[model samples]
Target chain A: MNFYDGLTFPAAGVIPFEHHRAHTPLYYGIQFNTSGTLRVRINRGREHTLTGPVCFITHPGAFFEYSLAPGERHDFTFFCFAGPRVQEYLRSGLLDLTPMPAAISREHKFVETLRELLRQRELGNYPESVNLLESLLIQLRRQTQISAFLYQTPRLQELVHELRAHPERDWDFEKEAGRLSISTQHFRRIFRRHTGNSPQHYLIQLRLAQAANRLAHSEKPIGMIAAEVGFEDVFYFSHLFRKYYGIPPKKYREEFFV
Target chain B: MNFYDGLTFPAAGVIPFEHHRAHTPLYYGIQFNTSGTLRVRINRGREHTLTGPVCFITHPGAFFEYSLAPGERHDFTFFCFAGPRVQEYLRSGLLDLTPMPAAISREHKFVETLRELLRQRELGNYPESVNLLESLLIQLRRQTQISAFLYQTPRLQELVHELRAHPERDWDFEKEAGRLSISTQHFRRIFRRHTGNSPQHYLIQLRLAQAANRLAHSEKPIGMIAAEVGFEDVFYFSHLFRKYYGIPPKKYREEFFV
Candidate 1:
């Protein structure tokens, strides 16, 4: 009943200063760069630079070469998993093979999960390792969808990051537009196109998310938490929290906080 | 590159008062009883009463019927995972398709992980659900190996539970043997056979594990923690802790404590 009951894990580890060329690999490969830059060329194509947190996939018989700068050492995790179902996933488009720029944040779960997978594999916990790999794949696939849109404009990505970093800030659309050297209407359109939410709605959602997290993790009073996340009115915060989470803040904390 | 990429999750959920008979199940099935008793008859064999926390696996074409008492309601989680690798695991002995009495404790991770898996599935997070299932399988397998030995004698099982619950208790092997109405030598042999350690050594391990956990989670001083785990001599505690964990308690707390 396990997901990887019969799959073969040939090799999985965190490699430093890895430089290799695979003419015809026997298994599917997933690799994520943890630090420094990696240049990867696939099937005699132009080389692509991978910096920061990034991941790529290579299937069997895919000619690829990856290397780092001279005398440069960087850490990266590589996983090789092979099974009949792998081909089926590729055919069904559930698993994308293209290289993806992961979330450009250091706190992204990709590297952490991969490291944990390697640790579990080293400890001979095959089932746990396989489960971590499955979770990592799902995270990578979801990141690809979001990152592809967010990375389209550096300015928008910066603004999104700022909003996430400080959701309590009283962010104004006009000020953000002026900072980006664009009209308010243009800013709203582009931001919506990239993030699927208008600026004000996005900020509200971020604040609510932070509030929910605090409610579940901290014993702070509901009014204090509301004000901390930029909601001045506790009643309105309760209404929004209930509308979004289908439960009042007090009940949410009671149910979720351990 | 992900496990369960091409596998089919036909159904996974928690059901109350479940009663079912399958002449030939089309998919691999895993079920865990959360509460009440479940009587399962596999392949027309003698019915087995499963009380407390227990899990069982059923494969395709396995004739089985499971039910509860009339008008009696019990909570259970069921999962159906179908793939070609299921047969391979069965053949290789990695997947044991048998009823296993899980840890006789309500705090086991089996139910929690299954509930989380169901939640993820309902939220349309297929990869997370699959990962949780894999992790749950690993946990169940590990528990099976340990529980089989512990359940051999109810008296010894009870003793082990007591030791785990109160590792700091000042235990004496002779007293335990006297309570069990057995000779000291016989008690040592049976305890070693059942737990793979002498009672004294097992108690020491339990105490050391508790100390390690406290070191990682609490800000309590090392000497106080040592005393709390029944170690009156801090130096001896540090020595044993170092021998078992490969690091001094201070360094362990420094490295692991967040």
Candidate 2:
């Protein structure tokens, strides 16, 4: 479920050793100085690797293993992100697989912007950090051509259609997982692995997004909208809206209407 | 800590109302409607009334209460942000407390941006929601002037000075909060209430920003640089640098030094 599984870089010391499939469905990154020669074993499947001091992206579903030879040292930093949408992007061939040197460049404005976002976030600028990271993630997927993942996964497509058709019905990981015939843990992992959230979280998000469209463009009371979206309590629905939108439902309605 | 105190607006048949306030301080945000008349009342401690869809920024340390009376309601949205910088801005007279209309003007781009940000979050675009929100928050803060709030609070001043004096300490918030004679919760809430982040989050940000400046301008071993900035672990430090700056420390040193 870690996007960083597909990624490896110099965050931790690159001890000179290798292990087989220690981390499954993960991104592995490594870095090395002149002290060691880096080696990798693509024992299981196919993956693309690039070597340089710039930034690059790792596509999802790609598998590989990496390490340094004996008496070798390498360094790397990586993390993972999960969800159904994440998987969708991976399979859609929407993300770029090329590795850019993991560093700043005047030419890669997107890269620079991503860096600024990361920097701002690290600065405890949570607001800035969140914004920049989200943008970077989206851009990484879009520019790399991984966006097709959503459209590519029939499971996701079926899920989306089902959710949209009955936005008011509650959803669960176990229920959906059972329907899909995968273990709950595996389903949860893949749900996050591919979509960036759990089944329940995804359903709420889809409902909320759709509700916003309706709120902005249609003439409907929040009560009806809430019920329509499967939220039993209008108050709860409004609360969710306010938390997410920073304004109350009535306020939102008033703003768009007269 | 609520920014929406000491202000009122026109309420049209329960057009959603949301407001926040913290006692030890006070702030005001006045709003108006698009086409109808907005009625406001400061019933407590002072009797004042105003109307419009206009918005006013409030500063901390002030005290007051307000409400938008039911009558004419139109589209409106507003929130108040306070920090040590906000108070400083208040005292310094950076934001003219002039009464303005409630019209959503083109010049008030941040306001619109704020609304849009809320919309995205409300829609539950989880992976995507955060970054957009942080950007809007940053933009909103940026649009305001920094006077006393930005420069004069003793705690904030101390925090800034410490950050500048030591560019490399892996600060722990609980310890800093202890030094401040307040609980961690209090410290974080207050710190963010003013500067938009907890104590430690801001410090790391300052350190990273400093490193970036060096990476862009100086020639130094990333290891040495990492140590100088209070980062005991060079590998971890560089990983952070790479993640935030999108380039490893060595590469950053190389890319910008030239």
Candidate 3:
């Protein structure tokens, strides 16, 4: 069956709450923790604390309750959707509507998609809304898989976080492995296993991503952006960007910069 | 059958050409005109000129050729995808792969989705790529329907373009209809039939959309944004914003602004 069909979104919104709780939602829900922290209990089981930039799902009649600490406001996007396809997916084990949340590595992308979804829905654009919902679900699923693997390798997770935060920093794989007290070869193996990219490749991708963001959002010069993203050679940076993005930096900026 | 499955994207890229022409492709192609105009002729039929911010699809084994003007560089994103599902859709009359292109009303959203698709493909994220591709196709289909209606009402189409360009202006529907030598009642009826929204509602949505874009991109005060978007009362603007976006402007900015 067509994946985009048969799913109906009854309601969705960006909401805020402080010390509030709700029980047993009538429909299946997908919640994105955008700010602060939220605690959710499924069927009175162990409470799962979801921090900002994470997502979790709740099934219909799951007896789930979520709340925030007193005086601490939590901002989140909640989507209520239900249909025969959702039921089929649930029954076939295609969807895991567990209470545990998954960390979102690309918060900006997640937020952008949600914003677009809201815009489409407001316009009564059904096709766009269904497509965006599917994209959001796919992103959540990918994040869940990544989080599961990262949970087993805490050190590598921290390293990955640092890499994302400071792609401009000069990173030496040997030094990173040394800090982790593992051989470089072992570090490479485990890093790839957990992140699906080698240390060098991952760092380069992060730097290129930063450069692309700047190219789209700012009036900064291409060479300056390259330097800011840890690329010492401007020509080499342009070449690499062309290889990755299928266009030259100047052309990309001209075509994409709004 | 899954809508996203069976479609394989063998190669895709952002390319620039000047005074260039190419003949029928081996695979089905979707091309977005990003910069200059593109002229395409299918099966030696009449040429269709697609200006920037439009998209067109090409079928496999079709005798099609496209060209760019001399000394005018055309930048476009080309995606090649083909599979059994595509053939099924074509056979079932589900996809209208005509040579004529459709205008993209929301160019920023279109470009953003394409960028995200490229990012996911680069990362080897299959699910995200599939979702994005499906979203893109759905958007194209919607655009085709809209263009067909808008093409029949050139006067109203011009008005719509002006409204989109300057939503902050005080718009009088009666005067707009008078300019086209039509009654206000008739204008509302035809506009709603063609655009799926009354003129007043459409203008308000445009204004609200402008305000939201400002909130996400600039650090301007909320009141200034409201005034800039033709809202005389900041409180009224905030109320409408909340009702439309499901969040206060302040919270939306705090949660979404990068």
What is every candidate's C-alpha DockQ against the true complex, given to 2 decimals?
Answer: 0.11, 0.14, 0.13
Stretches of candidate 3 off by over 4 Å are A1-3, A88-94, A153-258, B1-4, B87-94, B153-258
The true-versus-predicted C-alpha distance at residue B106 of model 2, in Å, is 11
Question: Of models 1 and 3, which has the larger TM-score?
Answer: 3
- Tens-digit lDDT track for model 3 on A72-183? 6667787766777676556633466752777788899888888888877766565577677777776676677567655545587788878889999999989988888878
Clashing pairs in 1: none
lDDT digits (tens) for residues A1-258 of candidate 1: 343554545445565665654445546778777767778888888888877666778776678777776566677667877766566567655477775345436346566677777777654455677677767767776677556655544577777878878889877889888887788998888776455467888788778868867886789999999999999999999998776655688976764453
Candidate 1: list runs displaced more than 4 Å: A1-6, A19-26, A69-73, A83-85, A99-108, A123-129, A148-258, B1-100, B104-112, B115-119, B149-258
For model 1, residues B1-258, the per-residue Cα lDDT tens digits are: 243454545455566665654445656767787767778887888888877667877676678788876566677777777766565556654467774345435346567777878777654355677677667766766667557645544587788778878889888879988898889998888776555468888788778868877886799999999999999999999999886665689986764453
lDDT of 2 by residue, A54-75 (tens): 2343333454455434443433
In DockQ, how does model 2 score against the reference complex? 0.14
- Candidate ranking under TM-score, highest first, comes to 3, 1, 2
Which candidate leads in lDDT?
Answer: 3
**How many residue pairs clash per model?**
0, 94, 1
Each prediction's Cα lDDT score?
0.70, 0.48, 0.74
User: Which pairs in model 3 have colliding backbones?
Assistant: A1-B1
**Candidate 3 or 1, higher DockQ:** 3
For residue A231, model 2's alpha carbon misses the true position, in angstroms, by 8.8
